[model samples]
Target: MWFNWLTALTKGVLLMAIQIVTDSTVQLTAEELATLPITVVPLIVRIGNQEYFNDGQDITNTEILTHLINDTELPKTSQPSIGQFLEVFDRLGQNGDSVLCLSLTHFLSGTVNAARQAADMSATDVTVIDSLSIDRGLAFQVITAAKLAKNGAPLEAIIAAVDLHRSHTKIYVFLNTLENLIKGGRLSKAAGGIASLLNIKVMGEVVDGELQVAAKGRGKKFLNKQIDAVIDDIKAVSPAKVGLTHVDNLTTVSEISQRIKAALPETLVTIHEAGPVISTYTGIGALAIEYYTD
Candidate 1:
């Protein structure tokens, strides 16, 4: 009877746990965890969703797991450095639960690869997942996985959940400057030039685990209008559960967030700034919006 009551109570709660480290954060559901037989979670550095982090204090920013990448000059490692991920693994392993690290992408950063190396080096059992998308496109997956693991789901089942729900998410980004992409080597100079020539405001959507350009418009002034059009398109397909993120763009953040809340009050809306890592590529004053459909 006690066990049955406990199960019911756990099911009733969100069963979520979130942790913050220097420049990123990790959120998981304590109810369903992948690393089994070991009940303690420690020494783990939750990777930031490779999205933009905002720097302004207009909103309460505490407990969001933001890291400082503001003007921190570091070599672009096409992948997260092995040393970086290893530190977290070693710490998490201290508690006897094998380290389970999350990676933003195998697409942009070798962050997951780095985690593999770290796990090998430390000989700590590790599970690394390539969310295939950045920001909350990946974040929601992490949250879902955490919940499953806490619910006593095996690692493989948790990973399957991550992959399954990831496919349902949509991510969109509109950047004011392409230089950040070029500077971080995420985009080619030619593509940047072409986008600039037409004063292109990009509209990207996550499809099949990749961020595909949905449309390109000619000016910053047309951005809001363009986004609205995209929203209309999404609505035609289905209603969406969305998340909002920004990098030094308060006005756009507030404007779009307000507009979205008005249009879809039933959707869960969250706004966060790009932490230092993602900011290095998207630059400040950029915005990313993400959502999901059934």
Candidate 2:
């Protein structure tokens, strides 16, 4: 009788199913994904005539950075095709599980639209959300939904909370060099050269689905300003999670993470390596911080 009760409990837990789907830009670690019911769809990374997938499992940011440092050419990135999204959706939909797919901002990439197209083709109930942010900012929304889903929350509740989370979440990026932006034709060479010569760092945030400059300064002034902004936000809001991501710049990221934790001792801080899609724009030695309110 006791054995039967334990078996029944296991079956009951298994029935409470919801799946999380996110793109490679979410930048979540392997260990974290193991604990949460999340599946990742990789973006495409191109260098010269070669192409690679930003799948968190096989391709990593470390390898991508190595190529950037050694090669003269800057890497390029693209959103996953609709067919790629369909493959993932069909697999996850096999068990009739409701899926919540979070994607990079529509302004930055067409990943969200691809997800939506796949959702319409999916057999199971699928809700695709435009996170309106990238990197860990996107991860925060996915993490929240996965947690709610694991606790047996209904699909509607999960979607509502995730939608709100994406709006409230904020991401701040610090670029040590403007070489990539200039190379990509997003910034003029003259302006990038001027900024580089002056040792100025660029800081930006994604607002209204667009990248906007939030702050800029040189050396310590720049670092302090960004850190101060984070500290101020924590003081005003109920801090749920903080993420520090860097492009092969762990030392600086660690220092910043320490300062953030020192300010809010109870908050959980996750450090991730920025993947190819983000690195393609930020260039080498870029770092970013993302957080959401409780």
Candidate 3:
């Protein structure tokens, strides 16, 4: 469906063309990213002494998981520098095109600030927006803006549409292990140790630009109940769109996708492998869902 849309866009004339820019944290598939009118600025990823750019390049979720399983130092991620964003903004705007920059939550990373600074330096009209969510949640807003832009919608209209989706969209994360959070210093060592001792599964939601616990329990059954409750909430939002992402956890993703599909047959679902920035926090075997509830 997306391919066909792109084909039509290529064949038709566009009166108002807008360029969409987003960082690598948005969990969009390579094919999807290639097909859209979007430019992705790679985030900086550091593992041990080696450095990688998430510019749709050599790094992948599988490689990140392998490092995690080997007990290598927890991967560290950083936002793109202002210089990097300035370069991308200049390239994408060279054709006198308007650019809309969608960035991951400012609370989680300084990528948004970099984009904002670059926008101020650019000669073209650029609007930078904080997605307030990462991974597929960020993907949701980027995709919506791309579609609106493809239809020749003005930049302001597309920005308004993305902002609306950002408000309604939510990301739910199910952590299969507490070690990553502990290693990354996101969770206190003491708290992580307690959760591990009890065999607890942590569930959290990205709210108000931060990840916070919504519910958690002792076993997978409780996780299933939590998934069901999330599905119920999505159902209440008529004609909704949903996205699912995982860090090398296909079994859990398949099960959750089946449940969500069975419940909301008409809802659109996009499944993606979590990218480097997101995988750094989610770790191996983490499953997440992103959807709109309005």
Candidate achieving the largest lDDT: 3
Per-residue lDDT over 1-294 for candidate 1, one digit per residue giving the tens place of the 0 to 100 score = 213334646678432222111113222223323443222211122223232223223212322223323334422324445776667667656555554455665656565676677778875567665677777676677666655555545456666666777777777888766665766666667656667455477765556655455667677767788777756755565445566778777777777667766777766666766644465566556788777676
Q: Output the better candidate (1/3) by lDDT.
A: 3
Writing each residue's lDDT as its tens digit, candidate 2 over 1-294 gives 212334645677555378899998886767779999999999998888888888754567778878888988788878899999998888888877878898988877889999999899888678888888888888888888888777767777777788788778888878876767767654566545566566588787778656666666788677667867776886577477888988888998898778777877888888988887788888888888888885
TM-score order of candidates, best first? 3, 2, 1
Expressed as tens digits, the lDDT of each residue in 1-294 for candidate 3 is: 323345545788545478899999887766777778988899988988889997657687778778777855788988899999999888887877889999988877889999999999988778999888888888889988987776767766777788888888888898876767666665666655566556588888889777776776888898878887877777777437788888888887787778778877887787888887778887777888788766
lDDT for each of the candidates? 0.56, 0.79, 0.80
lDDT of 1 at 68: 24
What TM-score does candidate 3 reach?
A: 0.87
Q: Total backbone clashes of model 2? A: 0
Report the Cα lDDT for residue 275, model 2.
80
Q: Could you give me the TM-score of model 1 versus the true structure?
A: 0.70
Q: Comparing candidate 2 with candidate 3, which one achieves the higher lDDT?
A: 3
RMSD values for the candidates in order, in angstroms, are 7.9, 5.2, 4.8
- Report the Cα lDDT for residue 173, model 3: 90
